[model samples]
Target: MGETIGYARVSTSGQKIETQALRLQEHGCSKVFQETYTGGSTTGRKALLGLLEYVREGDSVVVTKLDRLARSAMDLGQIASTLEDKKVDLVVLDQKIDTSSPAGKLMFNLIGAFAEFERDLIRERVQEGVNKAKEKGVQFGRKAKLTKQQLESLRNDFAEGELSKGQLAEKYGLSRSSVYRLVKSEH
Candidate 1:
């Protein structure tokens, strides 16, 4: 009924944007915006942002797959919400999600909920891993690689006033902070 605008993107330069473009043209899209680079995030994507900016109330944005539009579920929700806000709809050919339909709206909500759930699960898994690591006495962040012997040598040097922290770090292939930690750990 209104203008159909196609937006196509390939993660890499080598991907054939032509197939999607041809599909869009066959679907009678007036024009298409094809991006050659990966849009992993919303911040640096010029073409995707431009497509969103140019979309009007009566126009529809088409894509081959939902993933082509976003990298993560959060990203998908954000972009979809923008289209919803602008009174525009999305036609993800692979997903068969025409946001103009009740089924499509339901599908979108379901997908968003699933994505959120996935994020929560990943967070929980990470916390569990951290807890397990702590139980095993596995230190997080950068570890103190120096042995007791090396630390003892550092302490001996410091006690004799032969080397400052900087010189000790230089001599031992460690940072000044590492030297300080080594000195503290020895005693």
Candidate 2:
């Protein structure tokens, strides 16, 4: 059996890992490795990598929470399963999950489910909000330099030779390319 190790993470400099470290040590962790950084797509959590390398069969790795280990369900799943493959058990104290037990396994699945569901719900809500805005006459495109009516008027003026491309651009606060586009559209 290898020594029990601790892994703690803080997303920002203002937060402290001392509480998590102390708890892990209290839970019989012999050595603790910790780091502070925003996480999600991090393939470079140095302390976590170090802990993984330090462990052997029967070695335990403790964390404060699953979210501290990963920002998303997929990332959490990968890291948790990797630890399991290494014969390293992960104990997330705050989540009350210990991957070495059947109950813990159930909890892991539930956490993953909830996390995925939350993200999906948020995405759906955002789309619904945008749809509602559109229904309420909100514009869904980039601001136009000239409206349809203004563009048509410009095209008519250019066709009648009342406005040259460069002259139209200067007069209408449009680019030469835009004036040319209007003239071409008229033709």
Candidate 3:
């Protein structure tokens, strides 16, 4: 057996990492890496990257929760793979996951699969909701900048060639590109 390392993270600076650090100490972690990072992705997590690089064969990496270690199933899988490659074990206290045993490995894989499945279900449901809204004639994106009357008047002004496109855009509080698009759209 090698050294036991711990990693703890909170999403924002306001949150305290002392609780996680205490738990890791109780779990026999000799060194603990702590950071405040958003759990959206593994990017910009220097502590995590350092912990991964620091561990060696026979070493164990411990965390209070699987979520504290990774943002998504894919991220967890990648981190797990890296640890596996380094011949290091992962111990997640809250989930009771210990990758030093066969059963723990199985449990970790199962949990990752379930998390990915849940995300996929959520994405599908959201798409269905969006499609239903579209069917019911719900418009999306930004509303038109100009009203129909305003558009007609602008078109009439452009046809008379009295004002330049820039002048028309200024009058309507629109960009020059918007004016060009509006005038070109008629043809």
Which candidate has the highest lDDT of all?
Answer: 3
Task: Per model, state how many residue pairs clash.
Answer: 0, 0, 0
List clashing residue pairs in candidate 3.
none
What are the runs in model 3 whose C-alpha is more than 4 Å off?
A: 1-51, 68-74, 155-166, 180-187
Comparing candidate 2 with candidate 3, which one achieves the higher TM-score?
Answer: 3
Whole-model alpha-carbon lDDT for candidate 1: 0.82
Give per-residue CA lDDT, model 1, range 100-154, as digits (tens). 9989988866765675576678879999999999999988897666667877888
Superposition TM-score, candidate 3 onto the true structure: 0.68
lDDT of 2: 0.81
Candidate 1 Cα errors over 4 Å, as ranges: 1-51, 63-77, 137-143, 180-187
Model 2 spans with C-alpha error above 4 angstroms: 119-187
lDDT of candidate model 3 versus the reference: 0.92
In order of appearance, the predictions have TM-scores of: 0.60, 0.61, 0.68
Candidate 2 lDDT at 46 equals 87
Clashes by residue pair, model 1: none
